[model samples]
Target chain A: MKLVPLGDRVVLKQLVAEETTKSGIVLPGQSKEKPQQAEVIAVGPGGVVEGKEVKMEVKVGDQVIYSKYAGTEVKLDEDEYIIVKQNDILAVIQ
Target chain B: MKLVPLGDRVVLKQLVAEETTKSGIVLPGQSKEKPQQAEVIAVGPGGVVEGKEVKMEVKVGDQVIYSKYAGTEVKLDEDEYIIVKQNDILAVIQ
Candidate 1:
């Protein structure tokens, strides 16, 4: 399903948590923990301020680092997705 | 600890999760679940584009709604904090 964010919010499909341990030990699927990373899939037009539109700084396909404890979890078409404002994004991975 | 975000990032101190059930049954401290909410404490100056500076839209003390699964969790002087880009913020709750 196509997920669209309202206003200046963006919808992100989370990147899967790592499956292997630091030592390269692969854990079973049942025991894998969720990864705290995501990929930007959709973005809103720039936020509006006093009748002027602020352009978005990030674009689709930017890999960003975010806080692990932010954002509300939503299940869209059985796929887990996250919605956050453009301002909440920390940094784009180069 | 005072957190200064780099660039257009912000540091948020999470609000405590609710302690009472929908029926008003107060859960014990040991059994309380973490709430998916936070308060804006600090923000970065606007992001830079082409060496020009932009101003931040949100300010300190704004209650914002965010995604459940965004941001990096950090421990600052024993307090838990989340760091995310300003863009990741969803909306300001008035």
Candidate 2:
């Protein structure tokens, strides 16, 4: 079953990190810090949340940077996703 | 300087835990779990926060139950306090 986050939550899928060296050697990101970048997968319908009126700013397919240590990780049908409040998202990349 | 919270933030002072048993024996609450209860010391004037319009709900001198681990602890003038969002407060005690 797919996750349907409530309130100002947004579903995000982390982008795979691939670093290319100057000589064009590709390296896995296993030894590096976990990237804070993710792609928006699902957007929650914005309305009132916790006594506040929230407006959804990010749409699906938008690349976003989220706060570290934010969101809950969920695994659904062999796919993993992070569910975070829209406020936890720091910025959208282009 | 006294703390003045911003946005929907609330400054709380933890209530001194004094439990009196049926036998009239006063007991300190240090052996038990940290109390989630606090007294509202300051309330922010709510407005637009993180692109959402928030309305202040709790007021100063109100006793509240806040979510555990949901606030930032600060020391001001040797007094410890917690600063939390209005959403972190679960209920106001009558």
Candidate 3:
């Protein structure tokens, strides 16, 4: 929770991929696709461009959707984290 | 330039892949890699999360880096555009 992101970036903890559908049938882990959902832990301080300031729109504690293929993956304390630009986020879950 | 992206999305015009290096030696056009750099054409109205409004950080005309494999590709009037979430964008060119 103490990680400080820079320049409109976000630190996310990806949700675990689901193995069971709503129908209650258990599925093999291999059949489940990677999860695009994540929980926001840290937010960037924003950046500047052409004399204009670009501020972070995502905040801490937001549940967001992101591109599975985007972002750099990292591991700390056996927990996975992904560092992505704010642009890579698809949506914030209400 | 008139496209209105939705929900933290952006409209990007991908830069052409380089076939020639600064030394002027040219690679076959077929062998050139796809470019991940793009020019921002339009930006979405940011969405809401947890009763807070998320605002756009990227603006039009930003030359940005992005994930090559992300976004939806579309063509209008022979111009190609990629609609990507804001998080898919990596960096803005200064």
Candidate 4:
């Protein structure tokens, strides 16, 4: 199923969480940190907001870092996706 | 001390948290929610970020809503401020 994000919103598939520390033994699922990186799947066409032209900066295929507690998680077709406003995204990894 | 935010970052002074619900009985400070609204105090110059020309959308004096879990909090001269990237700002209240 395709995901279509609405205004200033985006859909992202999370990157894998880190399972090991510097010492090299893998940690359990319960000890894995929340993933902050993700690949953009879809982006909304930003429009007018409060008399300002909201611009969509990040596009599909861009890998981004987002706020940990900022997005809503959804499961569709057994795949997990995160939906978040553009503002919650911290940066686009080059 | 004067605050000068770095590229695409903004300095904001938080708005007061609600002391009570609609019914109007004052609540304790510990029960107050984290403030989501803030007045812009300073704005950073728009600059290049990740090969993209990052533009500053909100100006000084705009009241903005930011991600609740985002931003770095700092205190100077007995004043508290939140420093956040432009993307962490959700909306400007016009």
lDDT (0 to 1) per candidate: 0.60, 0.68, 0.65, 0.67
lDDT of 3 by residue, A1-94 (tens): 3567777678998654534333222223332223355689888887663344566776789776565556888887778789987766755545
Per-residue CA lDDT of candidate 3, range B1-94, in tens?
A: 2345546788889765534455323345454333377799888787652234667788999988776444665433346566777878888988
- Name the lDDT value of residue A13 in candidate 2: 90
Give the lowest summed-lDDT range of ten residues in model 4 chain A: A24-33
Worst 10 residues of 1 chain A by lDDT: A68-77
Q: Chain A structural similarity (TM-score) per candidate?
A: 0.67, 0.78, 0.72, 0.76
Error of 1 at A51 (Å): 17
TM-scores for all candidates: the values are 0.43, 0.44, 0.45, 0.47
Best-fitting candidate, scored by DockQ: 1
Model 2 regions more than 4 Å off:
A1-47, A51-94, B18-35
lDDT for each residue of candidate 2 in A2-93, tens digit (9 for 90 to 100): 44455577888977543443532244456342337789988867678865678999999999877635455543435656667899898898
DockQ of 1: 0.06
Q: Give the worst 10-residue stretch by lDDT in candidate 2 chain B.
A: B24-33
**Model 4, span B1-94: residue lDDT tens:** 3555645878888775534455322344563334367799888676754335789999989988776454755444456566687888888877
Candidate 1 accuracy as TM-score:
0.43
Q: Score the docking of each candidate (DockQ).
A: 0.06, 0.04, 0.04, 0.04
lDDT of 2: 0.68
Best-to-worst order by lDDT is 2, 4, 3, 1
Alpha-carbon deviation at B58 in model 3, angstroms: 19
Spell out the clash pairs found in candidate 4. none
Across A1-94, the per-residue lDDT of candidate 1 in tens digits comes to: 3554545676677665544555322445564333345789778666553234657787889887554334555443345556666666777768
Candidate 1: segments with Cα more than 4 A from true spot: A1-7, A10-94, B18-35, B49-54
